[model samples]
Target: MQKAVGIIAEYNPFHKGHEYQIQQAKEQTGANIAIILMSGDFVQRGTPAIFAKHQRTAMALLGGADIVFELPSFYACGSAEYFSSGAVSVFNALNSIDFLCFGSESGEIDTCRFLGKLLADEPKLYKEKLRSFLKQGLSFPAARKSALAEYLKEKDIPFSEDFLDTPNNILGIEYCKSLAAQNSSIAPVTIKRIGSSYHETSLSSEYPSASAIRRELIAAWNTQKFLSDTLKNAQPPAVKDYLCALLENETFLIEDDFSLLLKYELMKNTPESLCAFSDMSPDLARRIYHHLNTFETFTQFAEQLKTKELTYTRICRALLHVLLNIPSDLPAISPAYVRLLGFKKESSSFLRILQKNSDIPIITKAADYKKLLPKEVHSLFEKDLFASNLYETVKCNKKSTAFTNDLQKPPIIL
Candidate 1:
């Protein structure tokens, strides 16, 4: 039987770093097939993907993934904990996977497992210390780190204080925690991230961060220099060609494109109403309500809302939930179904094994939800559909093209 490894990612624009990760995952795990669980139209950072999901899916397939599954919008635009839990749950539901591979700065699976186990266990001392830090007005991430450090100190556990600082390491820890919490059989694997840091904004290295790539792409688009050599070198050949085609067609989207929609969402809702959306606390909702008059653009408003306790990405995600109408009382964790976005034609037998092993429905056609999902599951799936339609509407309006329903589109098979 063919072995498979699962990867959870956004692949916002599918760069060379991502291609390398997929290649290394297969090589390290000795897996015959790689399955990707990717974010849809929206990414975790509360921004629309630069290119559409299907385009990214094609890039993933070309980059070496056997099959690609869409992580629903609710989790896609959620915090690291929710994002990891939802993704892990989906992979767990797919019983054929042998391993879950992720890229991390630490690249220490044992350390990640230790931290994950500590967090999942949540001992009394850790809880007390965490609460104390929170009461001192520290942000959740800060509080958790401080609490964990203090708890480890008292327990005499050897660890590094900087492990929680890097984005990839933090996410990797969350993945480990999720796997532990679910008591999953799938083994966790980590590959060290190469080249630029996650937040690096300069395109000077052979493998630039996605952030740097996005910045370069946006700058090039604004200046009408669509085919820069620096940008070309940062991506895989297929992704480079796809990006060029998208640029030529003027089909790419950016954070500012949804400003009008966000403004409308803010204008109509009171602070109380806004608090109903996921990640919208009472304080944040009130702040957003007061800041409505000064709102200029999505990025600008997120900047305006930034504070010591609330990060810019958190604010953007909260505002996105408001715009998308994601409820605060939605399920705590777990995805409803596995929505296939694309696949390589040669992976048919592997796909069959996955289908036979999966516990939840694998949705290939958007229109067959009624037959494939339960009532409550269909309700959750509807949010994914609405998000896709909303994204399509924005893209179409920007391009001056007719609106096409996302449900009518078929999964990409290459």
Candidate 2:
């Protein structure tokens, strides 16, 4: 029996740091294969990926993943809680994975587990503190941290709430919480993040942040510089070549590309109606409606709506829900099927093992989804198709290329 480690990621643009993580994961766990559950066209940050999912999948396979599966768009674009729950649920349902590995600022699994337990079982004092902080107008994240700090202080727990301040640690805690909530058997592991901070915008380090790489790519694209020059040391050789080839022929997408589509969605809805979308609140809906006349681009609108209570990423996510017509009430948090994106040819036997062990269907062909999935699950799968086609349409329109519907495309067999 071959051991496998499960990784949840957005590999927005596969870089050297990501390649290092995959290598380290396999070595640390002594696993025969590393399976990745990655975000599709849209990521958790409420924006489209800088590169399309298939392109990114190719990069992942080349970088060292044995198999890559798409995390459904609903969860991919959701908050940390939803994203972690969805990914952990899929891993649990698979029943063959041995470990769930993630990167965090603090590489202590026990601390993360303790915090996860505290959060999952929100004690009375913690709840009251949370509400009191919320009443004082702190953002949900800030309020939660403050409440946890006070509660832990009273309980005489020595752990610092400062761990929650880092993005990866926060997400790692959410993963722990989800694993505990589902009573999953998969063990959790962490690798300390290296080189750069999550939001750092500098490209000087060997393991530059993805945000920095994207910013550099955008700058180079605008100035007509080659990707090789811009990302010479930041990406793995294969990924760099793949990206260079992609940019030579296709248009790389950015948030502003969907500005017109978002504007159209906004034009058709009222403040009351807008509140029906995921992450949309009464206040946010009103603010969006009030500022409709001043809207320019998706990025601009999100920035315009940002406030002390609402962070910029949250605003972007809410606006994206409106643009994509995602309802506030989702049918299920757990994914119905595992959608294969790409895999190495040598891993065919491992793939079969996964299929044999998985409780749900493994979707390789888009056209066969209706036959393989339940009615509700089929409907959920349709959103992924719609999102891909919409992304293709925008990309094609921008590049003056003919529209090739991605629905007919099968999983990439590397």
Q: What is the lDDT of residue 140 in candidate 1?
A: 92
Q: For model 2, how does the per-residue alpha-carbon lDDT over 1-414 read when each residue is reduced to its tens digit?
A: 699999999998888889888988889999989999999999899999988899889999988899999998888888898889999999988889999999999888899998987888889999999999999999899999999999999998886777989999999999999988888899999998998889988898889999999989898889988764547688888878877778889877999999999999999999999988998888899999999999999999899999999999999888888877778876255668989999999999999999999998999888898889988777788888888889999998989999877678778888
Off by over 4 Å in 1: 331-333
- Reference-based lDDT, residue 10, model 2: 92
TM-score per prediction, in order, is: 0.98, 0.98
Using alpha carbons, what is the TM-score of model 2?
A: 0.98
Per-prediction backbone clash count: 0, 0
lDDT of 1 by residue, 1-414 (tens): 688999999997788999999999999999989999999999999889988898889889988888999998898889998999889999999899899999999899999998998898899999999999999988899999999999999999887899989999999999999999999999999999999999999889999999998888878768877667998999988878877877676577888999999898899999888888999888899898888889999999999998888888889889889888898876385666889999989998888888998998999899998899988788898998999899999998888988878788888899
Show the lowest summed lDDT stretch of 10 residues, model 1.
Answer: 328-337
> How many clashing pairs in candidate 1?
0
lDDT of each candidate versus the true structure: 0.89, 0.89
